[model samples]
Target: MMNACPEKVIRMMDDYLDGEISPSEEKELKDYLQSCSDCRKIYQELTKTIAFVQSVSHVQAPPDFVQKTMAGLPKESQRVGVKRFMRHHPLMIAAALFVLLMSAAMMSSFSDDQQFSFTKQENLVVEGQTVVVPEGQTVIGDLTIRNGDLRVDGELEGDVTIVNGQYMASSGVINGEIEEIDQVFEWLWYTIKGTFQDAMSFFGGDDQSIEE
Candidate 1:
């Protein structure tokens, strides 16, 4: 908002939302909001957010909620036990996590075996790191090329998935999705997300929007 609402008007808007603004102040705020789209947008957003919260029925915790929670928690003397344990034995925890991460990464890398790994060799030509679908050749079934790039100068009847690689789509007819995935880190991230989402779906939870 290059030209912002006056500070007094902003305070008036807040007061108006809270039902504490004087009649004159409320009029001033409305007049300013009508003229300034920037302030009006902000005010509209504030109204939506506030209205959502305000419109909800007042909910009270169960009678035993506080008691149950307090009973489950440790006594004050030992409340900081976990923190103290972590502080004193950081090395052990760190070592275990480091080993686990390394083992998982190693297993993933070994399983990948990206040395010219692919699915379906028919109708495709491999030239070093470049996989090519020559002109006039039509390949059937999905083609997954790992640790390599693909040049599609011909027709592909199914999906073309490139792992840790790139592709050049020229004058070719691709009948399905052409997916390009980068190396280990990205693959690992997607694997974890997929697993988590699967678990959530299984439990009837909505898919979470988790981003890199």
Candidate 2:
């Protein structure tokens, strides 16, 4: 699609779409666009892509997603085509990012309260979706909190891991490591490990494993 137009015409087309072209340049682009069917088709597709992404994919953006995604916009002068395409299609990126983050939050396993859906040991506070380790108490075993946040105000003698959640620690002491999983890939890794932790352990996998 990019090679369908002459390089100069492609640059003018991008400038025209972005409304940054001078009046004389605008006239030149308009005349070329009128005669170039391939460029016209590409323009229409770009307009449709923008319209669909903006109108259909109204997303709740993740924190810092805009800055991170915007920072990825192509900048190399040799990649003007890539830069133009990414610049005009930012809503698409936002929609995809929102989907990934939301999948972690609203996934079925997290929504279900069944113990098999998640994992935990005794001697902890459970309120709605959150799990809390009260101050002055100590947990003897590994801790896993799924689809919810963990407030750790006590000492945990074993590893602390969370899936699709946040971990907040207070002045309490934890003798083991802590982890937070906010992405689908990490969640998948935990799910697989939880399902096969024993089998993996038999093959030399460490005892430090995700429960669910």
List lDDT for all candidates, in order: 0.75, 0.69
lDDT of 1: 0.75
Which sections of candidate 2 miss by over 4 Å? Answer: 1-118, 192-212
Could you give candidate 1's per-residue lDDT for residues 23-96 as a string of tens digits? 88788788888998988998998899998988999999999999999999867766466556656775674566
Please, what are the lDDT tens digits per residue for candidate 2 over residues 51-149? 787798567879999999979997667667655554677556445545555454446555452342235666788767777778889878887776787
Clashes of 2: 0
Report how far off residue 12 is in candidate 1 (Å). 99
Backbone clash pairs for candidate 2 read none
Model 2 vs. true fold: TM: 0.36
CA shift at 8, candidate 2, in angstroms? 99
Q: Give me the candidate number with maximum lDDT.
A: 1
- Best TM-score among the predictions, by candidate number: 1
Candidate 2: C-alpha lDDT: 0.69
lDDT of 1 at 172: 74
